[model samples]
Target chain A: MPIYEKHDYPLVDVRRYLEPGPVVLLSSAHNGETDIMTMGWHMMMEFTPALVGCIISPANHSHELVRASGECVINVPTLELANQMVDIGNSTGTRIDKFKEFGLTPQKGTVVSAPMIGECFASFECKLANGKMIDEMGFFVWKVIKAHVDKTVTAPKTLHYRGGGEFMVAGDSLDLSARFKPEML
Target chain B: MPIYEKHDYPLVDVRRYLEPGPVVLLSSAHNGETDIMTMGWHMMMEFTPALVGCIISPANHSHELVRASGECVINVPTLELANQMVDIGNSTGTRIDKFKEFGLTPQKGTVVSAPMIGECFASFECKLANGKMIDEMGFFVWKVIKAHVDKTVTAPKTLHYRGGGEFMVAGDSLDLSARFKPEML
Candidate 1:
């Protein structure tokens, strides 16, 4: 039998443990200004329309742009972008143009005004699904309109934020599809 | 300069690429019945007060339980429980007792009525923060009141769901703490 022990710890750091998905670059545009911000707090909210929920603090520059524009591009960066992502996350976009500072290529999107980061393995064009909880919770719900992936990189090593400048990159993939129900597949 | 090509893909399966953190077991109890369900679709929503957002489909039995009780335990399971986690996820708690069948010890939580899985590395007692979009969005907002983590394990390997039955285990951690501003530390 395995023994478990309990310890008192700060709950604020729990995000380091439970955040489920990879850190993403949220690019927003409004009034001809485009900015990319590093984001780790987001999740898939629904399946059919492919809704996504993300929490962007009111303090973030991207928050203002996303709120004003009602659209953003979610760029999925690999482990190679770790340093740039940290730089993007650490600095305020209000003071600097992230695209030019980071030397990232911004590609035009077909659906939204937000430009996708060319270095990322995939990008999702999303429109604000709902903004009801934005004022109170800093929560923005987005619905994916179009998705673009680089088919050349079959398996991308994406960075997973583990809080406090730490990250875990995706390793080998294991298949357990046989254990699931047919409907789930 | 890096070249990126655009390829149209199914938007629904984007979770395969973006899922960032560890898969969790959401345990709920209501009407004298308890259920443990495997969940990967969750994200950290806020910092202070520690809010989390999770999408529980209206079809799952645990969803009904969580809705009725307004409280649950978010259990963070390590890679060891990956198989059992899938089995529990595949099977509905409506027909059988998940606690007994999965051989997961049900431990009383300090803040919520739901039991925590003893085998898990960490457990968070969460109370439903808001249910405004329960019907329309299947999204639940939770506030962590109490948390329990196994103190013995310094670095536990956690599982990240990659859609279908594939998972990416939390691998080596990299420290980029020097790159960030002091306040971000």
Candidate 2:
């Protein structure tokens, strides 16, 4: 369905629904071309071997780049860089150079051919263990080989998604028992 | 290895990151008792079969619960329901009646025995996909068997996580062109 009239089902943009950490714009060099796209659509899924998952569509420019490069970086962004995030999300590499347009720093990562954004708070250098995609919504399954983070600022006080062109930084954390029960912290 | 202290590393509560569609409180019902906890740790790993990745600790009361049940009801929630989200996060089913105490309504799911939350916006019935996890952060890998979003709340806005004790909600979606570029959209 190209467009549903009246959207009689939940049709919220999923991009806005994901706001866990600084969303890293994954920059990948594939077939001699580089493309980056904002992703909050990633997660850690398993424990025995530390498996992680992220979704991307086959049509996405980054999809081809990642496949060619066989890897990508999960950059964690801060709220100070939300505008850049928006720009990356809004623009596409096929039309314009996202690096030049957004002025994001592209640095070489340790393990993967995909470069990491130096501006991100952290980076996860990931390898494509396997991939499966849904036709209606493009989602990618991934596995993480190595990951890293920065804690210069309060790391946990990061981005939160609010629907409708809205985003919220985390409110001050309250220890449930300490604040409410007066016994546990 | 036991106590991972964040020196200059980004540390976050994994529970706080799941952008809320379903706060899948998966657990194992053992010995005729139930133990359930909230999960915002899941993300779409794949699009085709809808593979998901999430974190569950061996020490968590719900850990053993997952081992026993091997199935779960991904109870969807809303921003107005944030308090309930935290309520389940804080109170462990290990010692108390989590469902009754939280005023949760359990409805029969089409695929899984784990009851769906009637009040929430969506439900994804899931089964365990046996897989290995990463070594650094022990997590779990699973797949969604079926999903049910409330047909009544088409385009329902809601909240989700980035870091800390915060949650984010869905926002208005822009034209596909606005989100991407002319070429990709």
Candidate 2 chain B, run of 10 with poorest lDDT? B1-10
Clashing pairs in 1: A20-B20, A20-B21, A21-B19, A21-B20, A21-B21, A22-B20
User: Which candidate leads the pack in TM-score?
Assistant: 1
B112-163, model 2: which lDDT tens digit per residue? 6766665666666667764354233435556667666544554444444432
Candidate 1 — which residues are off by over 4 angstroms?
A1-20, B1-20
Candidate 1 structure quality by residue, lDDT tens digits, B22-136: 7889999988899988887788776566777888888898989999999998877777787888899889647588989987888887668899888886777889999998998
Per-residue lDDT of candidate 1, residues A151-181 (tens digit): 5654567788766666777776667889889
| TM-score, second chain, candidate 2 | 0.74
Cα deviation at B146, candidate 2, in Å, is 3.0
DockQ of each: 0.32, 0.13
lDDT agreement of model 1 with the native: 0.76
